[model samples]
Target: MHVLELAKRRKTVRKFLPDKPPKEDILKAIKAAKEAPSGMNAQPWKFVVVDDNWLKAKIREACEREEEKFYSHTKGELIAWLNAKGFKPEKPFLSEAPYLILVFGHTKAPYWLHSTWIAVGYLLLALEELGLGTVTYTPPNPKPIKELLRVPNEWKLQTILPVGYPADPKPKYERKKLEDVVSFNEF
Candidate 1:
């Protein structure tokens, strides 16, 4: 499929089937991710693929704790939207998905965060092409998760992607009109 179509078809999969995806397919997506451009060619991203049930459970517990704190303090439109979408402090996907791809960025690299996110975008699309599902889940505080994953201090946690075959059908979401977000030269 075309890249744009792949992008459009890729949705945030909250519920996933229990079946595990092939390791080679996940590696293939990572292969695509590594090709993304980075600042000064300093490919400063690291992807940790987790498939252990015990580790996934620990990760889920840590994420839920942070999410609880976040939900307690946050208010307004974002919370309302999340509530409308049936989201909660509990992060079941962490344990339910067959695999978790933990993305990290080396803090010392210039534009590390930006570069890492670009790579994540590439990963998401590649996974979509390979018929896998995932959602970008960023913990409110990554310190605990970092320690749990045994990630080095120099590597900052970017996001966690819970991957599997989607359990539910993809829902259609509307996007803003291109003209509404576009301009000719000046704002």
Candidate 2:
């Protein structure tokens, strides 16, 4: 598909089919993510791909615990924003999706966070191109995740991604125009 068409068609999918995606496709996306440039050639990103049902359930449980707290007390603009997206404390898709990619960053370097985020961007686009749907999520409490996944203390959880085929049609969301977002050399 053309780049522009792909860009226009891609959407953030939360509801996913139970079907497992091809491993080759997942690896391709990760390869693309790793191609992203990093500071001083230091590739400081690690990913944990979870496809097991039991493990996914554990992750969902942990995420829900954090989300429950966030939803009950969070109000005003943040609540309004979340409401617009139709988000709630329950995140069943975290387990429903066949793959959960746990993104991590090295604690040694501050620039690693930015590098990892750039890599994640590449991963998103690659997955979109491959017709796999994904959404980047963050659990309020990553402590359980660290313990459950046995992630080394040196690596910090950066994001959680649920990947699978979309269960429903993708929704087209409006975007800001270039003029609305861009500035001509001055803010």
Candidate 3:
């Protein structure tokens, strides 16, 4: 598919079908992600794929608690922004999706955070190419996730991607025009 069309069709879908995608497809997407360029070729990223129901439940529980606190405590512009997106504290997709990809970055590395995010972008495209849908999620706190997932202390949990075949319809969103987002060499 053309890059433009692929990007245009791609959407962040929260609802999903219960069917699990093939493991090979998941690995292929991860392989593409790992190919992303990193600072000094450090490739300071790790992906944890979670498919277990029990573990997903645990994650959902912890995340919901944090979200409750976040919604209650956070106010003003942030709340308005969330409301505009139709976002709520509830997150059932975490447990409902067939796969949960946990992206981790090496904390000690200078550009690990940026590199990992770059990889995540690649992963999103790859998944879309494979006819899968995902929503990138960032939990309120990492401590619970680290403890529950047994993540190494040196690695920081960055993003969570709930993967599955989409159950929801495509949402219409208005994006800023190219002119509004891009600036010439001299800003």
Candidate 4:
């Protein structure tokens, strides 16, 4: 798929098919993440792929609590906005999707906090090209995510992404046009 088309189709997928994607496919996503540019070439990123049922349950439990708050406890328009984006309290996709990709951004990397996010963008775009669906989540108790997954202290949980074949192709969400988002030579 062309880069532009793949990007256009990519979104936070909340529903997944029953099928699991192959390891190689998952690796392809990692490859892109690894290839992402980092500060001073430190490449301060590590990916922990979790599929164990017990572990997934724990992460899901943490996120579910967060999601519940996001829906019911969150104020006015935020709730509707979240719903429009396909985020809901019931994230059944956590169990349905076989692979839980945990992106770790290392704090030890001397200079680039933003580079970690660049790597995530690369991974997400790459996964979309591979005909898989991915949903990025901020797991509660990020410290425990590493412990639950047994990742090192140097690395921090940047985000948790669920990966699998998509259950449906959702319509593209509205986006601000480039002109609207951009300021020509200066702000």
Candidate 5:
């Protein structure tokens, strides 16, 4: 697909088919992710792919523990804000998706503190291009998940992705006009 078409098709998948992608496609997506440009070639992205049911359950529970606390106490605009952006208070996909990807960003590597985002962008696009679906989440509380996954303390959990094929294909929201977002050379 063309870049623009791929970009247009790439959307946050909330519901996914139960079946997992073929191993070759999964590996290809990871390989595509590695092609992202990093600052000074640091390439500081580490992904932990989880498929075990027990671990998936644990991760979902930990995520919900934090999510419940946030929803119960957080009122007013914040709740609406998150809801509008498609944040599900209870993440069924974490347990139901065929694969879970934990993306970690190493802050101590070189001068690039944001190289991990490049890898994430690449991963999402690659998955979309390969007829897969993914939901990306960066929860405020990640230590519990890290401990559960046995991720080293030095690494930061940038996001948790629930990946699989979409349950349904539909046109997603359109972007705002560029005229509203751009300011030419200066803001």
Candidate 6:
């Protein structure tokens, strides 16, 4: 499928089937992600693929704790929007998905955060191409998860992607028009 079509079709999958996807397919998506450009060729991104049920449970618990804190503090339209979207503090998808890809960026690298996010975009599209589904989930606080996963201090957590076949029906949302976001060399 065309890249734009694939992008349009790719939706954030919160509910996932229990079946695990092939490791080879996951690797292929990672390979595509590696092809993304990095600042000064540092390639300062690390992807940890977790499939262990125990680890997933631990991660889910940590995430839920942080999410609860976040929901309590955040207010106004953001909270209302989250509620309208059916998002709650409990993140069942974290444990329910067959796999979790934890993306990290080396803090010392130049433009590491930006470069890493570009790579993640590549990963998302690649997974879509391979018929897998995921959501870009970032906990309000990542320090506990970093320790739980034994990630080095130099590597900062970016996002967690829960991977599997989507169990929920796809949601339809509209995107902003190209003209609304574009510029003719001037604001």
Query: Sort by lDDT, best first: what order?
Result: 6, 1, 3, 2, 5, 4
State the RMSD for candidate 3. Answer: 1.2
lDDT string for model 1 (70-185, tens) is: 99998999999999987899989999999999999999999999999999999999999999999999999999999987888899999999999988676857888899999999
* Candidate 1 structure, TM-score to reference: 0.96
- Count of backbone clashes, every candidate in sequence: 0, 0, 0, 0, 0, 0
- List runs of model 6 lying over 4 Å from the truth: none
In model 3, where do residues sit more than 4 Å from their true spots?
Answer: none
Report the Cα lDDT for candidate 2.
Answer: 0.89
For each candidate in turn, the TM-score is 0.96, 0.94, 0.95, 0.86, 0.91, 0.97
Candidate 6 residue pairs in backbone clash? none
How accurate locally is residue 143 in candidate 5, as Cα lDDT from 0 to 100? 91
Question: What C-alpha lDDT, on a 0 to 100 scale, does residue 158 get in candidate 6?
Answer: 95
lDDT value, residue 135 of candidate 5: 80
10 residues in a row with least lDDT, candidate 6: 166-175
Report the poorest 10 consecutive residues by lDDT, candidate 1.
166-175
Clashing pairs in 5: none
Q: For all the candidates, what are their Cα RMSDs to the real structure?
A: 1.1, 1.4, 1.2, 2.3, 1.8, 1.0
Each candidate's lDDT (Cα)? 0.94, 0.89, 0.92, 0.81, 0.85, 0.94
TM-score of 6: 0.97
Error of 1 at 159 (Å): 0.6
* Cα lDDT for residue 18, candidate 4: 76
Q: What does candidate 5's lDDT look like per residue over 1-187, in tens digits? A: 8878898888878788878888678789989888888888988889888889899999999999998887888879988898887666798988998888899987778644467888888899999999999888876699999888788877889999898899856567688898989987798
